[model samples]
Target: MRVGLYPGTFDPVTLGHIDIIERGLALVDRLVIGVAINRDKGPLFDLEERVAMIERECAAITARCGGEIVVHPFENLLIDCAREVGANVIVRGLRAVADFEYEFQMVGMNRALDASIETVFLMADARRQAIASKLVKEIARLGGDVSKFVPPMVKNELLKKFA
Candidate 1:
C-alpha cells in the first residue's frame, strides 16, 4: 500500500509540518504521522495532546487532499516505529542546510539499521521554512501572536498552556 512514516515530536504542529505532510502524501498511499514520545525534550504539549492536534490538522488536510493520514505515537527507534506502522519509507521535512545535515546522519543510521526502508525529504515551502515548533512555543510564551506559524486551534492551545 506504500505506507510512509513521518516522525517528529510535534509538540505543536506547525504550518511547516502541514506543508510537508500534504506534499509527502503525494509519494505514499498512507502517510503515518509518527509523534515521537521523547521525554528528554520535555515537550510543551503532552503526547496525547500532540496526537490530537495532529489528528485535527491532518483530518482537514485529508478531507481536501483525498489521502489517508494517521497519527501514531512512538518512543522506540524511528525505524522501529516505521516497522510498526508498516511503512517502507520515512518522510521528513527539510527547512535548510542545517536540517539537511542532521537528517543526513539520521538517514544513514536508519539505513544501517534497516536497508529495506527508505527516507524521503521534502523541502518546506519557502514562506513556511522559518517556522519551527520551538520558535512558535517561544513566541507564544512571550505573548507574541503565532497565528502565522500554527493553526488557530493550536495557537489557542499554546496560549492556554502558557496562561
Candidate 2:
C-alpha cells in the first residue's frame, strides 16, 4: 500500500487544509495527517485540540474519499515520523510562489535526510489559495468573522476561544 504523510501545525483546520487533504488522498492508499508540535512557533491551539479538530474535519472526507485519514501527533524529525508510519511520500500544499520557495527548501532537506522518501506538492484550489491558518487566527482573534475560511467546527472553536 502507498502511504503518504501530510504533516502540519494545523493550529486550527481551515478550508484550504481540507482541500489539500482531499487531494492528497488521491495519490496514496492512506494519507496520515501528522499534527506536528512546533515548539519554535507558539500556536494558538494545543496538540490535543489540533488533533481533535483535524479528526472532526477528516471524518467527513474519509467516507467521501474512500480512504483512511489518520491524525497522529509527532514531535520528532519528520523523516523519522514518516519512517515510523511506513510512508514513502510526504504530501504538501502550495498556495503561492512564496509557499513553493519555502516548501522547495524543506523538500530538499527532507530528501537529504531520507533519500528514499519523496515530496509531492499539490496546488491549493483557486478560491482557497488565499486562506491560511495564521490569517484565519488573526482575523478570528480580532473579532472578525472567519466563517468563510474555516469549517463550522473550527469557526465555533475560534469564536469561543476569542470570546
Candidate 3:
C-alpha cells in the first residue's frame, strides 16, 4: 500500500492542518500524522495532549476520506520517523514562499539520508493559508477567538490551556 507521513509539531491542531490531511489522503492508502516531539520548541501542549488533539480532529476526516489515519508521536529525526511508520512519501503543506524556502532545505537533507523516500508539497487552501498554530495559540492566549482557525473541540482545549 502507498503510505505517506505528514510530520508537524501540531502543538494545537489547526484547520490548516486538517485541510492538508484531508487532501493528502487522496494520494495514499494510509496517512500517518507524525507529531514531532521537539523539546527545543517547548510546545505549549504536551505530547499526549497534541496526539489527542490530532486524533480528535482527524476522526471525521478519516471517515470521509476512506483512508487510515494514524497519529504517531516521535522524538527522533523526521526521516527516521517516516521509516518507522513505513512511509515512502513525506507530505508537507506549503502556506507561502517562506514555507518552501525552509522545506527545500529539509528535502535536500532527507534525500541525502534516504534516496528511496520522496517528499511532496501540497499548497494550502487559500482560505486556510494564513492559519498557523503559533498565531492561533497567540490569539487564543490573548483572549481572541480562534474558532476560525481550529475546530470547536480543539479551540476549547486551547482555551483551557490558556485559561
lDDT of 2 by residue, 1-163 (tens): 9999999999899999999999999999999999999999899999999999999899999877789888989999999999999999999999999998899899889999999999999999999999999999999999999999999999999998999
- In order of appearance, the predictions have TM-scores of 0.98, 0.98, 0.98
Q: Which consecutive 10 residues in model 2 have the weakest lDDT in total?
A: 62-71
Q: On residues 1-163, what C-alpha lDDT tens digit does candidate 1 reach at each position?
A: 9999999999899999999999999999999999999999999899989999999999999999998999999999999999999999999999999999999999999999999999988989999999999999999999999999998999999999999
Query: Model 3 TM-score?
Result: 0.98
Task: Please give the range of 10 consecutive residues that has the lowest summed lDDT in model 1.
Answer: 39-48
**Model 3 per-residue lDDT tens digits across residues 47-136:** 999999899878889777678999999989999999999999999999999999999999999999999999999999999999998899
lDDT of each: 0.95, 0.94, 0.94
Which residue pairs of candidate 3 clash?
A: none
Query: Which runs in model 2 stand beyond 4 Å of their true positions?
Result: none
Best by lDDT: 1
lDDT of 1: 0.95
Clashing pairs in 2: none
Count of clashing residue pairs in every prediction: 0, 0, 0
